[model samples]
Target: MNDLALRGDNIVKRFGAVTALDGVSFTLGQGEILGILGDNGAGKSTLVKILTGFHQQTSGTLSVHGEETLLKSVDHARALGIECVYQDLALANSLSIYHNMFLNREIVRRGPARVFRLVDHKQMRERAAHLLEDIGVHVPSVDLPVERLSGGQRQAIAVARAVHSNAKILLLDEPLAAMGAREAALIIDLIMRLKEKGGLSIIMIMHNYAQTLDIADRIMLMQRGRVTYEQQSANTSVAELMDIVRREYRAMRATTAQ
Candidate 1:
């Protein structure tokens, strides 16, 4: 097997007296999709936060390209070629597509020899257009404000930004949560294309088993802040996954019935 682009070993995180994650571990290989399935409060969000460096792991090792290092913050993770497209997307509603695409790292032209010092709107816009096109995004134009784009277009923009950054590891937190079926389909296809064409390593948190199974190379089931099971998508059926969920739920209900 190819080496994992990212790996988390025995990760732990806590909030006050609550242990949100306990010894969670996983590996994400390049050009592969790993789907995380869990109900609310199952540590799915916590895991993503820790992975993206939004929240520090209380203990454990996070290795990127087989090198273990401390990811102090989101900037550190980004510097290591990791970017997360959160559920809310964090897009700038008031900004143009190009501006939002290069929000922080603006390209600047310092007078004499085109020294990079200013927001290179020209170059950014060109790159943004090409990125969208390469991802098969059918946006009307790259210069328009993001507010003018459709929901699917906005999602495509978010994903394109992540891809354009040369992010080796992509963490997506329920990108399809509020989207309609059609829009979700488009986003899903875009994700698959990212893995197939862009060779991105992806970790997606999703509740929709069927959708997860459709594109994921592996599915990991999390319960009560712990991963209880994992299965290869090709070797497991949705019905089986549903049964696992149902069984776990029933067991929880039964325990609480006392």
Candidate 2:
């Protein structure tokens, strides 16, 4: 029970006449990285939303940390130690790194009255610096504007923010998207560092098969709203994954022509 962080049993989702997910099931283990691979409409985002409490599963059972329950809202998910860092990174470019780390979750002065609140910038800065350092993310200063940093740096900051919120389960959407080799390597290292730090489990919605295989302990491939294949990363190859996708495409083409 403690080994599992999350599990979904025969999950389904529908929007009007369109079914976004067709009986998908999966599991994420504690302190393990699971890479979800699929095409554009393979229900990856929908599953992510459901897991993060942005959307409810039409019919399924979801368990978080051995407790079978349905998440009510993003805050509910957060209360259960679930957090997501979307691809947009969602950082205010004009704000400093420390400010972004505490975005919408700022620390207020301890003795301030309800109506007279003031942000504790010094505390946030020191804490943000410590967190970043602990996570192996080194930057010039926590006071620098986020826009001044590189793409990978921005991504790291977003991840750090989720961690600062005390996330036990982290979901990353397209985490390595649109980055050069060096930048991608930076984030990969960060992800590994988080795993090594202990007590954090991650699910990455990814497209690059090679990268996923390299980073994930296990891999699950989705095709048109269904999980078609799943395997331990160590046992799978890029060639085998491409073969499975090709077979599915061929079968679809045959059905369409009939």
Candidate 3:
């Protein structure tokens, strides 16, 4: 079987006269993590939106497992085993952990009296507990509301929920943003564990160079709606990435001055 999980070729996106993404092309391998770094307006989010089916590209093709695909909608992306966990985490604070885990896709009892379509709360709770445990997420109780959990725990719940949903390619947008050192460490460890588990591909949008270097198998840097650098994490350094950014900034300043 081909080990390539996802590939984008010459992707372009335009909003009227504004070109948000300019011919971005990249490949994500199975069971590997690709970290994206960029300044504001670097087209990182735009590329991710297109990959996750939140937006359609004006031009370019996407391939999944070597098959060309046109991601029509977010649901269509999910149907293809693609899921995104954004910075917001998107959890219902008032709902129980299991309830939040099952969110839109709830389990229903199957029987003659199934017309009422009662949710299988028991099964959901058990499975939620199992999934959290499998992912090494610790909580006092699965029945507790998400509002009662800490930031790191809430983030873990979001990731675990995505994993439980059978996500093959996971897109995470600043998963560690606004987090303290301890909380960020928790999510970082979880991401590494997920990578070690195999069969799951991850694309992470990150701003922290140190953390990206630590977790990503490969690093991609974007500037002004285009990719400026791509390399294996093991072969690159934070200083090198900063130097690239500085050079780009200098060039932009020179052009504006002229």
Better of 1 and 2 by lDDT: 2
* Candidates sorted by lDDT, best first: 2, 3, 1
**Model 1: how far is 28 from its true place, Å?**
1.4
TM-score of decoy 3:
0.97
**If the candidates were sorted by their TM-score against the true structure, best first, what order would they fall in?**
3, 2, 1
Candidate 2 weakest lDDT stretch, 10 residues: 109-118
Model 2 steric clash pairs: none
lDDT of each: 0.87, 0.94, 0.93
Model number with the top lDDT:
2
Please tell me which model should have the higher TM-score, number 1 or number 2.
2
lDDT of 2 by residue, 51-105 (tens): 8999998999999998998998888999999999997878999999999999998
Off by over 4 Å in 2: 112-115
